[model samples]
Target: MEFDYTMTTIKPFDVAVLAVEEEIVKAGMRVLYVHDVQKSLVEKGFQRDQFKIVEFCNAKYANEFLNADIKIGLCMPCKINVYVKDGEAFISGMRPIVLSQFFPHADLGEMPKEIDQIIRNIIDNAK
Candidate 1:
């Protein structure tokens, strides 16, 4: 099964980052964190392309999945990444449905499919 959802954007890296955060909120998910991977690396005396990791979650959905199988906590708080590579900007995330394959014993019901669509929508709109 496809495990990732990715989209290339013509928007600048900074613009794509804001668009992603805005889309996440518009989709009714709360942004938990934004990790500036490149900044972190640069601060440590390294240089790399721009990259940001945005983490978000819908409380109700998270509760539902966790209740279904506590082990699902390992995947809690979904993430979408914004990055510049080879002069191109990209917005991407792991497909939520992939969790089903990772935890076959858990009954995810319709949550993964639902989340997968929301994430894909976010990436498309952000781009």
Candidate 2:
């Protein structure tokens, strides 16, 4: 199974990105970083435009999971990136289920479902 999923066909890339960020914050997650990719690339070495990545995380959830297994720091953080492609804004995130699979003995039984739903809600609201 794939770890990443994408939402396509969104209009006004900037608005869509903001909507997703709002939804994520409303769902009790913290916006850790919002990178304007175009500017970042230009700062680095690319000429791309209208691209951004929003990194988010819920402290409560992250702490709980981390306390359960310290080694899970390999995937300690979670993020969702919003970017433009073909003139449309799209959101993408890593599937928690796949990430959890990396630690089979960690007992992430209900956590994956909860995380997935939170991500889905953010994506749905973005649209």
Q: Best-fitting candidate, measured by lDDT?
A: 1
**Residue-level lDDT tens digits of model 2 in 1-127:** 7788778844587778888888988999888888887997898888885777788888778887887788877774777777776666678888787756787778776888799888877887777
Residues 1-127 of candidate 1: C-alpha lDDT, one tens digit per residue: 7889999999989999999999999999999999999999999999999999999999999999998899889887899999988999999999998988888998889999999999999999999
TM-score of 2: 0.87
**lDDT, each prediction:** 0.94, 0.79
Alpha carbon deviation, residue 90, candidate 1 (Å): 0.3
Using all chains and alpha carbons, the TM-scores for the candidates as numbered come to: 0.97, 0.87
Model 2 regions lying over 4 Å from their true place: none
**Local lDDT at 36 for model 2:** 87
**Which residue ranges in model 1 land beyond 4 Å of their true spot?**
none
How many angstroms is residue 61 displaced in model 1 relative to the true structure, after the best TM-score fit?
0.6
